[model samples]
Target: MQKYTVLLLINFFLLLANYSSAAANDSFTLGVIADCQYAEQANKGTRYYTSCPDKLSTAVEQFNTLPLSGVLHLGDFIDRDFQNFTVLNTISSVLNTPLYHVLGNHEFSIDDSLKMRVPETLHMPARYYSFEINNWLFIALDGNDVSTYGWPKTSKRHKRNIALFNTKYKGHEDWNGAIGAKQLKWLERKLNTAQTQKQPVVLLSHFPIYPENNHNLWNAQEVLTLISQYSTVKAWFNGHNHVGNYAQKDGVHFVTFHAMLDTDSTAFSTIEFSPNQLVINGQGRQPSMVLPIN
Candidate 1:
């Protein structure tokens, strides 16, 4: 009986060791910032537009000290001026890891001629794309794909935006945009592939699709429905509402990060990803969270 008990204890320690090794192998950390909206403009309401460059510089400095896999900037890089992107770019150039950008409505608030240059200026591979890190799939979505301001007046997306605004989204905020049908189909395919591979998905966007708010995406319901069908989707991270919000439904986390442009203080976070959980270490105004992936 004593030998059997010793054997059981040995097995338990081995199991714990295996679990720890697996968790450590799959863990990685990423930096997150939203709405750094840099511009040489007067503060509008709570948004301190000019403070962005300095804040972003500081944030990058802090992020440089960390062992981060990457950093995701959830759009609104500039308030309006196309020139401001250059200033913000210089500040973020010091970041030690790869930087990802999501298309935001405010990114389109420039001259009609420069509208098409937004993606190129940001160095995005595509308006919507996906990448893998630590066996986890990260999908960056362009919520502005079908929006009133994101596309040129002659484009089909611009026309579709007008039709949706006039009919389906009459009461919604015009500043919020939608994921176009083509993009939705593409997302579906990606999710399907991820599902087949048993890979967990983390969606990155500039617009929120859950919690039923005015700042939510124009086609939030459709997006929600589509994502719900895929069990592999673990979380959706966004930033458009400066105040920030969080909600969980159907085991998916919907987190709207606080905007860096909202106040005099800063907002950003380091998200540590593990096999079964995500630990968010929020800085300044952002709140930390522990989300279980199971």
Candidate 2:
């Protein structure tokens, strides 16, 4: 009987040790919401344009209760009218966690005069930037950097991108944009730094670079080629394909989050990251996923 008691105590202590080890890991959670696309306009097809403010409020309220390191909104905060940002801003202001933004093409769907003001309007440090949490590097890419809509009609980039789109991506939607040479080089440098430090990376973009979808980034292959070379890049999180998608390639998970503007359900997610895996706890229309890190 004494031997059995000792064995039981040893097992209990081992379990406690395991739990403590897990707790000590640099694990963290982040809230993710995509394509809120709020506007005062009426519903257009499946997009409940007017429902965004309330939906975002509900998501923010829920996030406030969670121990989130930050909350990332994967762009398209408004469907149109620049004034709509005011209403969305009010809703996002109450979030207790740090809010991060990624630029979406629709964010530029306003007067050309307001185009350059988008980064400032969204409170983004830059159109594309990087931040680190618990040794994990999160790189945010501005896919709209070389787009048709984000620039004035008379701008050289606008004309060049339009011409490029007409020539190569004629069958695909022109709404998609690419990471320009400068941004691509910058991304390479960031990736190199992460790799040297053995830090895992999570890329945030408004466009997906996988699965050959029409909603993919204009230079999807180029981005894909670059990312595939880096084993430190564990995942790519994106929006713009409101339907949502997931694909795994070269040990990297490509996740396209569902738009909050679609359906009545309202989509959002919280991702818990550990040393070994990611636990994606989805809310509403979003689906939960468990992705293991290699």
Candidate 3:
């Protein structure tokens, strides 16, 4: 009986050590691209709209060579033309892995009658939704939910957005936008569930929420406060500002990637998440950074 008990104890210790080592070795890489803003227009100021297709093709070729679990476009996949969506589709289809998209203001730049088709074109389940990948929750938000530029001028939501912009934001601009009340509630529920499940979260939005700027979401402060309530949120990724920015608050990392539209060169990155740290491997013009996970 003593010999059997000693063998059982040794087996249990060995299994425990193996589990620890496996957990430490677990990691996943995610491909990230933002503000592709593809269009067949001449260069306007800093944005080279006509050059995005070649840039996207290059990005897709690079991503295909990488061992990424999935790819996420932080939005502005096209500029202001509905025709550009077809070009985007052609360029992005070369990606061999799963691809996800978040809606940006440019998605609604078409006529109001065709605005509803944008989501379907991008293969998004909804304007705002959540998905799970390797024990992490990714939440994609629609910042254009209340934008004057995105919503139809005759619609009540557009009027409400204008009123809010005038009164609350002091008429910031039609380019800026906010998440609606329903979406806010949905986000809260998702965060609560993630907390209960002990899952880490990576939030994706088209508008910046931190390091306040003209391109930030209209209700950015509210969104920031809401996210800070949940400890499970590890990072927030965004675009819209185009210049790119980074900040950390209350244990969450806010990272904004540069717009692919700005230059003739490409801008994209792959992010690897490990047990202890998050590493961003930038390609083209995107800047790399290493962030420790809490």
Candidate 4:
């Protein structure tokens, strides 16, 4: 009887030790789905527009089974039509966790009068906003704010964007956009607050800000410079180029997730954030990589 009691105490101690170890290594996972671009329209180029609904369904079903803190759709949730938002929402409803969105340029493809309605359709509180999960701050930026493609031709903002594109960034076209002065100030404030709180940040946008691609944001350099100024900023996740890309600048990881609209296969990812590293568990066409955080 005494031997059995000793064994029981030993087992209890072992279990307690394991629990403490797990608590010490606590990590969180985020479900990432980019560029669903769902529509009833037929395929265009490599984008299988009609396949997105089914693909999103699969992604949601899979994400529901994982231990995700939340799910983030990087943008371009629809291709062109407003009607496609209904389909995208229905498919995304299967997710058991909270879902967040970033506004993509394609979201404004509807009539100029209805351009502001896109955020409402997505149920976002604002065009750009911030949220927190597990001691980390996530900022979602609206890359279409100063773009010529989404605004009415006669609008001042549209004209200004066109002029800026033509004069300074002639190489970039209407599809790319810049972050206006107001948004830039707001972003700076958010970063300052996060730094004051000693919280790490992950930025989300629809337009890529690095790799010097044609699909990059019109003011990529400005955004990159702002982000580089903040040591608390750890990663920038985006989606615009369907091919996908990754880069690291000033200890910040810039990851452009592959578009879910491309190919019949689904493209999504589960990103696990630990104290030392960021682990990406990619599904379908999304490539996996583990990045060390400074």
Candidate 5:
């Protein structure tokens, strides 16, 4: 009996060690789509060539190749029509990898259809949520971080934008770059826990959180103040102000993909991470570069 018990213990320890080694070497790829507005047709009665997606369908088809660890669309999945349930369901269900979204102002700007309904079938869950995968944490924010502005129909512009933002964002004061008290508090708690565990964290939102984000967070200075306090927070990703723009702030790199609606067409970004470095590259636009760890 003693000899049998000792053999069992040895086997258990070996299996545990093997599991740890396998997990350490595992890596993954992710696909990012920003501003698809799939529900709306291109060249919608308006002459606003400045913003639109002519090649969104083709790009999404490419992502369907699906080997991605997962995929995320930063925001603006559809335009002014939450009732475009068909589009929402099609893409959400069709994507090969699990899909996550960062709510853009357009998402809240629910227009004529279905009247900006909340708790719909398409939405996954609460606005703020995070996930742990392959031992890494990825956080997705409901709204923007800077100034915290939204799609409430306060004015003509807000009225148009509210087609999506009005659901919970209506009656709420608009913001251009402020992380609201609620989100900031939540973020603090999350970041503290991450730091305590010595785990790396990646942040995602529709608007920019860093100076390189183009539009500054309502109080970017304050956001940075909080970030500087934590060492575990690694990269912040966002996709709000569209393409023809890119910036890197402090150690945080702000990446904006080419607008799916524009002539620049569809593009994808790949990030390769190692213990010593994180590499970022874009497919259709912007010259790729490397950031060495300091």
Candidate 6:
């Protein structure tokens, strides 16, 4: 509880100094990137992707040039590696701002034999975690692992909960996009804390949280129920779809963005916020769209 309490206290001050009530202005810039998907040394036949560290390096250069608050990568930072995670590690060091992430399917390509390799190359203190930024509780969730979930059904103490999930979401995407029971519990605690502070929540996950919105989380309904319980969740941002667009349910917004670099043709989104409204601007593409982040 001390850890949780201390985390809350830290965010309280951070949010006060960072968050704004000015309504999403054309200022207070942040970079929205995803699916950098860098692979080292592509084969002779593959023109769709090139193993270009400089491409990422260029992106870092762009980040450094821009006066931005931070960067959120929706995942797939690399196309390969477990034991030797060269691609992501290289990019992590190059970027000068705070980097936040969600897990793409590629990040979990490692086998248990090489399980020692982790998300740590980015220097994240915790893998699945949350933080407060500009009056928002941004949650970074891992969407590819569910077998290790410590849920009620999997935990034996809550057969009823397991039965409920089995009835609704069994056999979905082989059940990979799960929050598991433990993370859901942790989320509940976070939601309560955010609620008490009157802060809105934003979920940053590799997989989409809603069913009709996109690829759909393995346990989409389970997650939806959780979101419904929290009035503070302002939106969910994702990037596996590789196509830039928006999805909305009631007041919650979901934005699925395109990849960064992979074929010499990629995209990056710029999100500008002030106080109430947030605008996501898609760049380096034909006929870009600007979406309201509220």
lDDT of 1 by residue, 1-294 (tens): 999999999999999999999878899999999999888978989889888998999899999999999999998999898998999988888888999999999999998888999898998998999999988999999999877799888877688789988897787788998888899999999999999999999999999999999999888999999999989999999999999999999999999999999979899999999878989999999999999988
* Candidate 4 per-residue C-alpha lDDT over 178-279 given as tens digits, one digit per residue, 9 for 90 to 100: 888899999999999999998999999999998788888888999988989999999999998888999998999999999999978889999999877899
lDDT of each: 0.92, 0.92, 0.90, 0.89, 0.60, 0.66
lDDT of 2 by residue, 224-251 (tens): 9999999999999999999999999999
The residue pairs in collision within model 3 are: none
lDDT of 2 at 117: 91
TM-score of each: 0.93, 0.92, 0.92, 0.90, 0.71, 0.76
Please report, as a residue range, the 10-residue window in candidate 5 with the lowest summed lDDT. Answer: 144-153
Cα TM-score of candidate 3? 0.92
Q: What TM-score does structure 1 among the candidates reach?
A: 0.93
Kindly list the per-residue Cα lDDT of model 6 for residues 191-217, writing each as its tens digit.
Answer: 899988988788898778753644677
Candidate number that wins on TM-score, 4 or 6: 4
Tens-place lDDT digits, model 5, residues 69-130: 77777776766566654556664676667877776766655553432343244465666688
Query: Which portions of model 5 miss their true places by more than 4 Å?
Result: 1-24, 39-54, 112-122, 144-177, 212-214, 244-250, 286-294
Candidate 3 structure quality by residue, lDDT tens digits, 167-234: 87776767878988899999999999999999999999999989878899989999999999999999
Give the lDDT of residue 84 in candidate 4: 82
Displacement of residue 3 (Cα, Å) in model 3 is: 12
- Which pairs clash in the backbone of model 1? none
lDDT of 4: 0.89
Q: Which stretches of candidate 6 lie over 4 Å from their true place?
A: 1-27, 41-47, 147-170, 211-214, 261-263, 285-289
Per-candidate clash tally: 0, 0, 0, 0, 23, 7
Tell me the spans in candidate 4 whose CA falls farther than 4 Å from its real position. Answer: 1-26, 153-155
